[model samples]
Target: MLRTGAQYRDSIRDGRRVWINGERVNDVAAHPAFRPLVDIRARIYDMQHDAATREVMVATDATGREVATGLALPYAKADWYAKRRAVDTMMDAFGGVVSRLGDETIGEMWSLHDGAGVLTSIDTHFAGNIQPHIDRILDQDLFHVSANTDPKGDRSKRPQEQDPDMLLHVVRETDAGIIVRGAKYETAAAYANQAFVKPTIANWGDAKLSEYAVGFISNFSAPNMKFICRAGFAGRGSVEDYPLSNRLDEIDTLVIYDDVLVPWENVLFNRHTAAAAFIRSTLHRYAAFPFLQRILRFADLLIGAALLNVRQTGLDKQPAVQDKLVQLARYREGIDAHLIAAIETAQESPGGLCMPNQSLLYTGRLLGCGEMHNAIHLARELCGGQICVTPSAADFANPETEAWLNKFYSVNENWQAEDRRKLLAYARDLMNSDYGGHRLTFHLFAQSPPYAQAGAVYRNFDWERSAGIVARAAGLSEAVDGRKEAAA
Candidate 1:
């Protein structure tokens, strides 16, 4: 069932408590800070119904029911291609990148669905809940997000030793379901419908039973849930000056679960440390594909901003400037190559779903996110100092300063002052503004930190293949192969 834009907006207007900038937002969809993203999300929903986009955004499931293309579980290379095309279409439509849309978050459910074996081994009842929820999201066309990071009060002290609520845990079980307490740092939680709440810390450390090892689907509008969001960047400046921030600021929230209940059907895994550990290791398996795709799009924005600035100023003729542009192109294509290569070498998940090549995907994530700062710096340098010193749109329009500003900002016949001002303003927001800095930090640490990214690469890479090659090259003993076999 494909949902329309109005339906999607109505779903979230359930009077959920949402706070931003120390004020309670009565209508998140109407609030200036959130309205832009909310409208974008709504437009994405509407795209499914629009005749031009319906074919690209909607697909038929196994049951012959039409659903959002992004929510459909990928079964073959064609399915992946369809999802990729759908995402590309949406990004093109929006004219900017915005993650945390339903497409990106739905993959978390697929990751857990792949872990049905682990879930079943722990408890058959737990395993039964996976597919139904997967169907529920597609059928209802709901917006889902993820929750993992919890405020671990002290790294050295355990939850029992310090504050028990530091990490989200099962407080107690009730007739309906289990009640959970604590919080999670979630992006788009205020506007999103549900979240796949789970443990962020992977290590259980020999304890067989732990309340911390719990996973469940929590409704965003449920009782005791509070979405306290960080101040938004939308209303901070004129749209002409901070266009991306105004339209693309995905407000992160500290979602407090004040003893929220999770119905039995909603609990994917509870008090099962093995299942929790499995999920933590493989949580981003499918999700990271879309996550990395966003970075690739951002790379395009960086390159475009830099090239436009250089071209407008006629600096593109310089060899040094061309080298910088080439470097930016390489960065963009590097991410693009990884994405295409991963899909080309796609692997089948244990649950029979097609997953992008894990090794390539993880390595690409590290490359895309880890080196984003350098790319941003290069783009910023290429845009020159003009981006920072450009006067506001108001100054250009002001009768007192318009002529003088125009005289200085205008470069040539084709390069007018208004055009130059707009380009610099865009470049600033993309590379130098508060929104730009926040985006960089998010790319750095959103899907775990740099250290964890390295760890994922280590865990997924084919070490045995390398080991066998080195053993043959160096004429080493067969012990290395034996050790690899033993490790496997």
Candidate 2:
């Protein structure tokens, strides 16, 4: 059933134990920092019921029950349906709010973990801890955030050798649940959601397992779960200055879990190293493909923004501008091609859920990182100094500056300077903000490290068969006479 925005809001109103700075937030819905994200998510929920978006965002479940794209797509046909669902998610994110709406991404990641859990006993942790949260959230169309990577004090050492608290660990276990202590850094959007899931990345070894292999879901407002939001861009000397400076895309947070109690139901993987590894690997694969698709969609927007800049500045007719635009188009087309290839080569899991071809999917991830970087750089180059010099929205309202801006900033005869400037500013925000940087970081982080990613591609590929065929053809060229050989 499609949930109303009000229903979704009311559902998450249940008291949570979230803390921000030093104060406890009584209601996330009422908090200023969190409200905008909630509003965005509410917009997504409302889209499920919208006649325009319903076809794309809503799908029937395995039981033939209607569910949101979050629930339905992971189990979908691994084809255009799955790809379309991913596109719908990115479109809903608007300004790439997933950094704040990390829960939605993690929720989808957990679905893959859950499917993997069904495959091996090693996946029990995911089945127990992560799957329940996914099921619950999917049923309610609940939004969530996630924190995964730890702050390694030194890159050379493993989790056990590092400060125990550097990585979130189960410090104490009680009848009620486990008391988790430590902090997870780069925890995107933890402050804006009802709850956040923490999944173990990869298990380094047995001894480190207890300290690193814990996975669970916790309410953002859970006791001792403190959030220190990264300072946003454009902070003025005044409170009002901060608002204008803060972009909606800056949703990353540092989540400190100070002896936070996570109940049994929330404990997805507790010291089960094997299960932890499988859950991590499976979720990584499952989420990465969809994430690549979303990045491609975002790239499309960046392309559109760049095109707008070119048209607005009358650079559309310039040979240089046209060349850059064509280059940008090729980049976008390459990404789209990879996405189509991944979808076309998709396969079904043993559990009957369809998934993209991992090889093609990872190729998309590689393309996503490089293409986005190029897109952003080309956009800046195309916009030239206008992107940097555009007056603030507030400046346009000042009568004195308004007249000058109107006279000087106009790009075309028909459009006012302020209007043209506004378009450029929006383009600048899309390509130049910290949020823009975060999007690039996300694409880079989506796949395993470059070497590992290349290795996966090489190892899984069938080069041996092709090599054998080539070797046989080469041997055939070296003729041997059977009777002569016997005489010799």
Candidate 3:
């Protein structure tokens, strides 16, 4: 069912296990570190009920019931729609800071397991891991976080080769469920979510370590689950000292599970090695699509901001500045063009779900990373050092420096120097601050390494047929020779 923003908020407030630092967080709905994320999630929930976004955020299920798009949409179609909706969502909210968290960004990942059947095989492991969570989370509009990649103590070693605890695993199984003991690092929005879904990065065998391979969903407030909050740029100082962007926190965290009990119903896949494998493949298959939308939206914002800065600084008339602006516009168009291409080339899977063309999606993903970096660089170059040299908001309130600061900082004759500087500062913060840096890192690390990502693209492509076409064009086909000889 479509959930209202208030319902979503109240559901999370009812009960959930979440910790910040060493203390148990009694009130996540009101916590400084988590409130911003909650606010963003609420906005997404509100969109479902809004007349304008309702069509995109709410869809009719196979059962013909109106449900939250997050729970009702099929994975393939959902993946495509999610990317489109994400662009609108980001644009509606101002930018990535107020945008939906990545975890919530791809809610249809759960739907990938809907028809995968039992999780006894290794190939189906990933689906097995997620199936249970899908059922549990559907009951309420819960914010779900994923923990798949573990902090491998040694980069070269596998989970078994390294310290067992280096990756999360189930230590024991009871009639109630399984007991998991280990830590999951780099979990996005852990404190803001109601439940955390744990899945193995890859499948593993050996009954002794099989628990580590199991996938399950558990309440964040489940017994023994601890949240160690990561440091945040905005939370480091007093509100007066922080920038306007500081209030919107997107902190990475470590989820410590010390013998946390997950009930059987919550178990999506348990020691079924095959199911775990399928989950990973399915996730990898659609991983690039969402980021493509995010990058496109970001590019649009960057271009708009750059144009504004140019006008504000009276640099629109400068040849070099205009050229830079043109180049930036082209870059934005290039990324967006690829996204459209990917969508146009989409195909349906065996399960009758639509998925974006893999080759085009990967190309867009890599291009997105480079484009975002370049966009930021262009903003900096066009804005000049004044982007960073602008005084703090506090300086405007000071009686002594106010007038002089305004006079010198003003760029265009008609624009108030203080107002122009403030706009530039906000843009600069988006381009220069830790918040900006985190987005860069997220894009870089979102999927596998660039080389691997490219390799997947090549592997998925139908190159043999293209090669055959070239061979035929070059008269290299034996059938053509045979026909010519017969005629002679």
Candidate 4:
């Protein structure tokens, strides 16, 4: 069932409607803005078939079918380790970070799989749809993405009062399936095969059933699905100056659903606010691990850029500079420690799948995302002012001023002018470019906002044990343990 790179490319050429920079794109795989990421994604697919990486990237299912390791269901700790290895291998192959790939998005389906029982309790009609889709992703090797954020017309007015289609809703149901009308802000939607579309944060009020409470898997190439993507960072500058920007820009899209039909099998839930609420609360339960892992790798890039900058200028000998480098190292280790601990103490999910420890994972997410801006600033400071004022690669190549540029940029026999200029250009793109700023914002809010992260930690952390310990320390009577039954 493992697809080749060519087959993967052929799947997305199904005439999906995609527009970027006010022009219609006939082939997303060939478009300059999307081609880099598309080719990287394709290479990941090819890696599964390559002799060197086939062992790490592909795994056998119970049925003896070979599947992409990234999409396989987790049955044991080894499964998790394999999945982690696959992600690491893919990133290593790409030479930069690309977050919206298949591994991160597939976990959303697993999260829904964990909630199958709760979904069944809410409505028995659609409970059976969860596992099949999860299996479909594995068997088909599909590239899946997520959709949650929608443009709500007004904060105060409800969807019913204002534009009804502000939030995605089920306008009507047909014998074939349901007709949905709305839009979602999704990353990698234009080139992706499918998206698990769902509602954003919604206040259901007292109503048990609302039209806004809907979740479905939509095919990207389906009729009336339009992908309006943000202008890509690629092709904005020479690749020599903006290497990371050109190679790793994951273009986001506004996916518009103009009365699209969702087949009955694709409907995960409908008209059940409780189901929607349950999903919203636990949406990132499985996905957060991969999402945070990307940030962890990014921390390495930050530390690398800063340390190289300091070393190139002989600033590493200074105590203050060394201390700053240590700070960045500690930040990187903090992310690593949480990830290691979460897996070591992994908990079993209701669906009989192993999950990263909920408490550590959520708190880890908070720590990694909450202080990223500070870490970036520290890295920027350590990289010094040269990263901003450095001359371009073109200037170094020009015969007119090449000698002067070389004389100033060269530090020692070991640190030649060309290497120094390359390092500075890399540092600038990693920390100071528009791409750098966009990355900061993505990590901060990609897995919900900071407040939501804190909320997850609050809900998952064990408070009853601490409450009991405090009660015992204070010598409270059994009747004063803050129990309603004891008070009664």
Which ranges of candidate 1 are over 4 A from the true structure?
480-488
State the lDDT of candidate 4 residue by residue for 1-488, as single tens digits. 78888888999999999999999999999999999988988888899989999999999866688898878877777887888788888878776678999898888898898999999999998879988888888888999999988988897987899888889999899998999999999889988899998898558999899999999999998998899999999988888899899999999999999999999999999989999999988888889888888888889888988988888888999999999888888888998888888888999998988898899999999989998998999999998999999888899999998999999999999999999988888878888999988999998888888988999999988766676677778877762353432246
Instruction: Kindly report which residue stretches of model 3 are placed more than 4 angstroms away from their true locations once superposed.
Output: 14-24, 51-56, 74-87, 94-111, 114-139, 186-188, 192-211, 235-244, 272-274, 475-488
What value does the lDDT take at residue 112 in candidate 1? 86
lDDT of each: 0.90, 0.63, 0.64, 0.88
Give the Cα error of residue 80 in candidate 1, in Å: 1.8
Candidate 1 lDDT over residue span 450-472, tens digit each: 99999999999988887777777
Q: Among these predicted structures, which one has the highest lDDT?
A: 1
In what order do the candidates fall by TM-score, top score first? Answer: 1, 4, 3, 2
Best by TM-score: 1
Cα lDDT of model 1 overall? Answer: 0.90
lDDT of 2 by residue, 122-159 (tens): 54433645555656666766566556666656667765
Could you tell me the lDDT of residue 215 within candidate 3?
65
Ranking of predictions according to lDDT: 1, 4, 3, 2
Which is the better candidate, 1 or 3, if ranked by TM-score?
1
lDDT of 2 at 171: 91
